[model samples]
Target: MSTPANTITENPPPISTGVTPQRLSTLRRWNIGLTILHLGQAAAMLILANNFAIPVLSAYTAGRPGTIGLTTSNLFDLRIGWAIALFLGLAGLDHFLTASFGRRIYERDLTHGINRFRWLEYSISATIMVIVISMYWGIVTINALIAIAGANVAMILFGWLQEKMNPPGRTITTMLPFWFGALVGLTPWIAMAVNISLLKDENLPASLYIILIVQGVFFFCFGLNQWLQYRQVGPWRNYAFGEKTYLVLSLAAKSLLAWQIFAVSLFS
Candidate 1:
């Protein structure tokens, strides 16, 4: 029996059959890009931190052979470098954990229990960063980071807890709170980036200023991407909040925090 024309017109074929080539390409690109960010950030941290050790240690040993020692001027880096390295290692671990999220999402395995635990892990990382920051500068903005980190803890524990039950279906327990935290965290970086962008030749050499501007652009782009991910655009448009988007956003936000929190310990 032939179907009626009106019925056939109303119920057209499904738009997608399976994962298309374009989607596979996008996934590959995302994986590559995230890996670059992970490794690049780690390398940058090591190089920048080691800047203090190289010349200062050489000078301290008065050009002795195979010398490795610290001096008064570079002591700040000594105090904080290890902590920064430790933090970077944790961040690197996040990259690996997040990489698995894509598969989990596809499997429809993203759960409220897992999300709450994820938030818990983030809270711990943020707390460690705060403690590390204290060893360098007692800046008031560090207090804001503290608040943000603490808020994540609260959101995971109080606001998100279904309490004594394995909740049904997929859910991001801490998505909205994390969005707010990310925005609030952007405050100091935005101000710094804009301020640095306005520096003149006398303030900093042209090349250095240009690098700073580039960093600013990176920060801005991260924020914009974050807004999209938060809204579940493109690859993120799954179950309101999906593992892939949150995973990438977490990496970006954590990288941003590392950039800001250790700015003085690093560059100075």
Candidate 2:
């Protein structure tokens, strides 16, 4: 009788490159999900901010003859909510798009260090930070342009950071972008707290309260998701700084958002 052919097959060698197909797919899915979630948030907030608050402010100004016309203070308060919502929306989209790019980079297994993508990350993070700061400082001239630039920068950075941190079989890099993204995303919310004293209107207070609550929910989910991803990828030696930073900032952001909502509700 002919000898039976061995049924066993040899195992394939490990990939000696940045990231793997499985991990890349997971990251892509995460990025896409984050993008969708943020986009949903942006759309919802836009509706509320524009449809509800703007109209209320308009009516308050037009209907009440003697009421101080939309004061600088009122405008500022309204804009604060608008800016936060807008930032969240843009950041969400940025994360999704950048992660997509990162996936491409990882797939190609580029030889350069993460620095290759640093410009992209820095551009996005810096631009977003600038727009947020400008809005806070009341620099309206290039706010829209800045917002767009920030979004683009953030997406590029997402890709760059992903490539830098998550080289194949590595867990540290995978979580880094999520953590950084959370921190960067939280900056606007933190800045908004400075103006909490300015939102004096009755309706505006209630609306803002709701928005803050929504923000909290958003970040809470984001943090939890990142943690889960970390669990899946196992451990690494990088400074846990990113995770710690994300948690702290996320909690702070949630707290501020909650406090504002509570403060607003008290008046209502």
Candidate 3:
């Protein structure tokens, strides 16, 4: 029965609105329905393991099913496809698990929260990309793979050194090694772009060129995001996001790129 003016003696806040957070919680609480949706997506991906059952199943992967697919055809393509499927399925499981028991994960594994998506995350992403590329390239490009391995090792070291140098305060320490690794990683894409531009012997679908360029640009975006986050620079200083938001975004972008590149390998 008491109003804001009647209750307060000094600096009273605004009057009541539509619904407070406590009232909203009662109306929109997490329950079994969200859990089921998450699990259903995970289950649906099983269709990806078998390409022959339904031609439409390939739609989940958004990939072509010509001559080979899933675990049914060429050894190289199979391995590549298998990795992509594994990543997608595991990602679905992650969402389900997070939804069902995100609090525990938040308290335990995700303690660092948003700060976790820094150099360490970039290192892990770079390692995963290298592994996938190495598997696809195989023995034919052993020397080239070795060079890539060396570059990745240097990349990790740089990331580590940069993290160590980073102090508690959000001072602008523009870690050069991070940029160095980013530039180094672009070599393969640049080579691919150049070869295609010159009409070389390499055979691949035209759409793949678009994918590759987009993927390269995506990597650059990641680096820029990291730089912005590190410095809290410019317009980025005001932006805010929770730990889970960054986790899902980082996973989705990196996984989607991996999936697409792996799918394109089948064309080669």
Candidate 4:
């Protein structure tokens, strides 16, 4: 019996690539393109880093603010652009290595659910981003910085667990891990917000407000990609679609953050 033309199934069969040659070829091309893009961005950022550096709190003594506990290396002096470069560079390396050697695993396409390389990269790169932003927001107390880094790392681990614990082909995605991950991720942002409100008594720069808005929106989009995938929203219903969205989000988010930061703080 033929189904009606307008009818659509609520849950379609998984679009796992099944290791087909054509699908692999397509994925290969994607990886290659992402490799070029990320590496190119990294190179450009390094060039910018050559001329610009952001002062970051490196070490501070607890006893006093001025002369009592003096130290030479109190601040980390380096271009945030360099850190952003690392973020892009790591992404490039992930793609390059996967395209060159991990062809077999690329076929997993969300059936296995977990992309370990992605979480691994996030563990370093994303954590760096959080720490950088936290410092930028004047949340530079040693304990706060450590907590921020730990929270971001935990968030990434929870993300890995989300996939590891719920391979789509083997079980219905419980989604608890995803929510837990979101909660963990929110911690750093909340800390940043609270710090800002408490610390900034005077008028804040307009650019800073813009930066906050852009960062918040892009971060939401990042989480939304995962939400859509699990909710089986259109396009996101395809795991590959969510993967592509993640790539795009990573590029856009990092680019925006890097250049905005450069323009506002580093361009001398």
Candidate RMSDs in order:
13.3, 12.6, 13.4, 7.9
Alpha-carbon deviation at 87 in model 1, angstroms: 3.0
lDDT of 1 by residue, 23-64 (tens): 434544565466567667767777676343211111234356
Off by over 4 Å in 3: 1-46, 49-78, 89-126, 130-140, 149-161, 170-174, 194-203, 238-249, 258-268
After superposition, which runs of candidate 1 have C-alpha atoms over 4 Å from their true positions?
Answer: 1-36, 50-78, 98-108, 111-117, 132-237, 240-244, 261-263
TM-score of each: 0.42, 0.37, 0.52, 0.81
Among these predictions, the greatest TM-score belongs to 4
Off by over 4 Å in 4: 1-23, 50-52, 55-75, 109-111, 201-204
In candidate 3, the residue pairs with backbone N, CA or C atoms under 3 Å apart (3 or more residues apart, or in different chains) clash, namely none
Q: How many clashes (backbone atoms < 3 Å, residues ≥3 apart in a chain or on different chains) does model 1 have? A: 0
Candidate 4 lDDT over residue span 207-247, tens digit each? 77677778778877877888887777877766666776777
lDDT of 4 at 130: 77
Single out the weakest 10-residue window by summed lDDT for candidate 3: 52-61
Q: Each candidate: how many clashes?
A: 0, 7, 0, 0
CA lDDT of every candidate: 0.46, 0.45, 0.45, 0.74
Q: Superposing every Cα of model 4 onto the true structure, what RMSD results? A: 7.9
- Residues 166-210, candidate 2, lDDT per residue (tens digit)? 543553535667666666655545545544556455544355445
Maximum-lDDT candidate: 4
Model 2, runs deviating above 4 Å: 1-18, 50-78, 99-102, 106-234, 238-268
Better of 1 and 2 by TM-score: 1
